[model samples]
Target chain A: MQVTLMQGILIGIFAIIAGIDFWWEGFYIFRPMIVCTITGLILGNLTLGIVAAGLTELAFAGLTPVGGTQPPNPIMAGIMTVVLAYTTGKSPATAIGLALPFSILMQYIILFYYSAFSVLTKKLDTYAAKGETKKFTQLALLPTWIVGLSYGIIAFLCVYGAQAPMKDLVNSMPVWLSHGFEIAGSILPAVGFGLLLKSMLKAKYVPYLLIGFTAACFIKFGNLMPVAIIGVALALIEYNRSKKDVENEKKMKAVMENVNNDGDDEDGI
Target chain B: MESKNTETTPKRGKLTKHDVKMLGVRSLFNQSAMNYERMQADGWTLAMMPALKKIYKNDEKGLADSLKANLQFINTNNYTAPLLMGLEASLEENGEKRSTIDGLRIALFGPLAGIGDAITWFTILPIVAGITASFAKQGSVLGPLIFFLVYVAMFFARIPIAQLGYTTGTKAISKIRENSAIVSHAASVLGCTVIGGLIATYVQITVKTKIPVSAGHTIALQTQFFDRIFPNILPLGYTFLLYWLLKKKNVSPVILILATFIFAILFSWLGVL
Candidate 1:
């Protein structure tokens, strides 16, 4: 479970890429699930990495950056969980308890990154005023490099330097607490689904949701791909039906307009 | 909104197809330098730099002024920002009035974000992430692989939307406005369905408690009732309760997370679940 020198460097590189990708394109590679998988792959335990990531991902899934507020940083949580899980040889769910503190710490680090970098905006303003487009562009991209490097450094330190402390933290947890975490780990995804449903649930689309839940609960699809295919098929049917309904309404309006125009012409005659 | 002359052909401007294509690529950085005060203003201005330079090649004052205008507290959803930037660039290229371009930019931000966030953040990401997460949980590599591939595809999809915004100008905006409802509806249906399935698949809440019916024959609520009658009812019910707390009661998600932790501990300790 020990991270090799090469593994630590590779993890650092991945962390750097995740940091830049977080803001640039937002492909969500920075998410705990994805990052942890990459870390696990480097550490030669892909299954452990994926399981650790899956647990942490659900915890953070409910925590999207809505408006100005920041979510608990999943990147740190995910990476640290994998590191702890590997070091201690504990269940991935137990690592969730150990990783919670780091997630909170990372949230503050992100706040610091934003507040500290806000000062650079003034310099950008000057460049804009001076019509220095090249400098303006370079300065604009500065935050990405800065954040990426910081993340890289943080990953290296965590995997290479803080291994003993993290291992101690993971090994010292009481049985009841670990059981609680296992329970929490299983149920936390509900919050994410709830948050998603909060935003997406329309009265008309409720039926489609029922269909999906029913299909999954009753049928043994084995994998998510088939359920997704079914969902897509249902969506296409719903979409085409709505499209046709709208078209019908439009036709009815046109016919009504024609009748009204004829009545006007008859009055003129 | 006075309609500007559509006769200003894109070919007359200095922006080549390659430059426009590059602008689309640069649009990926729309929030890289984001801050609270100006939000994405820096990124927006940066993304449009190549196009703005060509449009005001002779007028240094024009370039400075355009840059300043763009850096004025412009925040919008990242997915839709590129289209706005492309449209703004095209307007500047066609000699559109400053007030008109600025007004349009300001006006479009709220609506575009409202629609864009709803689709991209609320619906699409959750559905995709939920599906991928389930696969990942099963120790399948396809989960991360599919997520990475689909994400790249959607990320590149913005490039074409930006290109469309630039080439067609205001017409593209109107078209998007008109068709957005259908597009949003279709996506929402798909999103909702996947999320529903995800609730059944991922949100695990199993009761292990059993009631004493007779000596040496205790009836387990999980196996005898919940499992046989309604397998995912507890998970579905729990999901709905949280959804209510979030949507109706406006509970802070952090509080909800804390509640989840406490509930899990208390319930497991009490042998309820």
Candidate 2:
């Protein structure tokens, strides 16, 4: 289960590309599923990679960076999840639990970058004042390179340098602790769903939520497609109703304006 | 006003179609230099560079002033940002006052962020991710590919959206604001529904605690009690507890994640989970 130097370097290179994409949000290849899949591909474990991608994706589903706030970094979590599972010969669930520290570590690093990059604004101001478009453009793009390179170095170190320690740590874990990690992994997706609901849930929409929950949990289906179709249907109905409401409101306003115009004409006469 | 500007300032530079296309391309880097001080300000100015350069080709002072003005604080959804960029560029092309362009930019970003977040982040991606995660859970390769393609499509969508902004100019503002409310409401309806289904399907919580029903016989709590009453009740309740903590108590997600780990491990140690 030892990671080769070549594998580590490839993973590091992938990390750089994903890291820049994550920062720029140019293409969203940094999601846990994609990151894990690529890592698995590099490590020559495609099935393991796909399995971990599914589990890890759900766990990190609702942990999106909204505004300034960031959840634990998905790229590191994704890379380490597959790596831990691959190196330690454990289930994806257990690897998810073990990979959390790395994710949080990256989160802090990114936050640090956010604060550190604040210093560049003064540099930007100066460039603008001097009308140095070339320097300004270069400086503007500098942070992305820094972000990508940092990801590369960290991924390389974690994958290659820390393998022995990670393996040893996994071996030393008692049955209870390892089982506990498994349990934690299974329960973590609830937090993601909760975060999503916090943003999207509304008092009026609670019924649709209940319907979806009921259908998915109680009714037997081969997959969740039926439930999703129901959701789409509801969405269509809601969309049409709201559109009509807007139209009706506009009509009412038009009528009000017409009456006002009549009143103005009478007053002028 | 148009006639007066054309006669008096015939030397004013105009942005070509190529310039607008480049602006859309540059908008991809809108968050490249994101920071805490002014957020996406530097990136915003960079994205507007091509148009700014062309419109102010002979006026260095005007170019610098526009750059300084654009470098002020700006935070908005990256996808919808090109719309504002196009609008600002058009205004600058028309020789609009600096205050007018700056004021409109500030005024529009908040609403654009709200609409973009609602449509793209909350609704479309989450729903797609949920469905695709199910496929990936079963080890289907289509999962990642589909999600990647969908996102790529969204990335390219910036071109047409930017074009829409440029052609419609300021007149599009009222229409966008009018439709945004309805669109966001419908989007959230779908988002909530999908999230509810996702919670039921994705969030797994099992209770291993057993109770002796009769002599030498134990009933499994998870199956015998919780399942008989309502399947996935524990997951639903747990999701609600976390939601309540997040919304009412204002607990950070990082804290919630850590606490979930601790409690899960503690419960596992107690043989309750």
Candidate 3:
């Protein structure tokens, strides 16, 4: 359970990479499953690592950044969840509950990072106004390394510094609070589904939504792929039907215009 | 309007392949120094610097003006940003009407954002992550591996899309706009169904309650009634309730999260949910 200096550094590097991957390229290397697996690989506890990853992933699943606002920092949560599980020998679910506070803390850290870099953006504006291409480029990319390195340092600290204290703090917690966390862990996924529904739901897609819900709830399919396939079929059918309707409408409009033009020609004649 | 300067002006072939490729790659950091006031303005202008420099090679003032114009408050989908960048760059290189470039950028950004968010955030990531999580739940290494490889492909795929826009110039905009709506809508439908399936599969809340019918006999409500009627009714209902609360109340997500925790604990204590 003791993380060496080299492992800490490696985790730090991964943190930087994940940071860039997040808001930069839109890749999800920072997702809990990947982060935890990497942590497990480094820590030589794949079983516990995967377990912690799964728990944290689900708990954080509902929380995604919409626009500039972040939902709780899942990347930070994932790292701490694995670290806590590896160090304290806690169950995956327990570690997730324990890591929730860290996740929220990291959210503020990110906001601060955003605020701190505002000055850099101002500097970029000046450089850009002056057409100092080199300076502008340097300042433009500054936030990447700054944000990435900050996250890296935090990960290193979590692995190297917070181990014993985290274990103590988690171990000292009263039973009811921890049980509450266990329950909270189970209940939290609804938030993600809710957020997703809030964002993705449209009146036009109501039938599809009902179909999806019914297919899953009534038929009780064990896997998601089949339901997804059905969804694809339904969506394609609707999409094609709509496209044809649009085309037909266009054609009708064209014909009406032609008929009006003919009537005008007769009047002219 | 500026036709007299065309004979003396440099032609449209100023930007080399390298510049476009670099712009495509650099567009990844469009949010690097992003702020609330002018989101992606700094990073975007920075990414376009090289391209603008190429287009306005001898004209420092033109480059500065272009850079300044791009620093205006603009936000759009990250994936298709490169395409806009490419379109703008090509338009600049071709000495197209300035107003035309500005108009196209403003017009395309909002719609691109809608399409990009639907495809990337709502549909692809959720479905892929859900499937991978299911695999990871069983402690398979393939879970993480699949997520990484697939996502990495999607990430790198942005480069070509940008290159396509640059090579094709403004002609591609209408095509992109036309197709994106359909793509976005189709993906959303698929996304909803998959998310629905995910809700059923992942949001597990089992009722472990029993009711006594007589002194010697007790009936398990979950097993005797709920499961028989609908297997994952609790989870579905809970998800629906959360969705309704979010939609109707416009509750702060943080407050809703706290409420969820409190309710979970209280319900568990009461042995009801």
Candidate 3 lDDT (Cα, 0 to 1): 0.79
Name the better of 1 and 3 by lDDT: 1
Question: Which fraction of the native contacts appears in each prediction?
Answer: 0.65, 0.72, 0.61
Query: For candidate 2, lDDT tens digit of each residue in A31-96?
Result: 998999999999999888888998998899889887757789999999999999999998999999
User: DockQ, per-model, please?
Assistant: 0.61, 0.75, 0.61
Show model 1 residue runs off by greater than 4 Å: A4-6, A66-69, A248-269, B1-12
Is candidate 1 or 2 superior in lDDT? Answer: 2
Best by lDDT: 2
Which DockQ-derived CAPRI band holds candidate 2? medium
Clash count per candidate: 0, 0, 1
What ranking emerges by TM-score with the best candidate at the front? Answer: 2, 3, 1
Predicted structure with the largest DockQ when compared to the true one: 2
What digit string (tens of lDDT, one per residue) describes model 3 on residues B1-273? 367566434553488888888888878767877777777788788778777887887776677778888888778878878888888888888887667888888888888888888887788777777777767778887778888899889877778878988988878887887778778878888888877877777777777689999998998988898888877788888888888899998987778878877886777677765
Q: How much native contact recovery, as a fraction, does model 3 achieve?
A: 0.61
Candidates sorted by lDDT, best first: 2, 1, 3
Q: What lDDT tens digits, residue by residue, belong to model 3 across residues A111-209?
A: 877677777766766887788988887777777877888888888887788888887887897666666667777767778888988988888776777
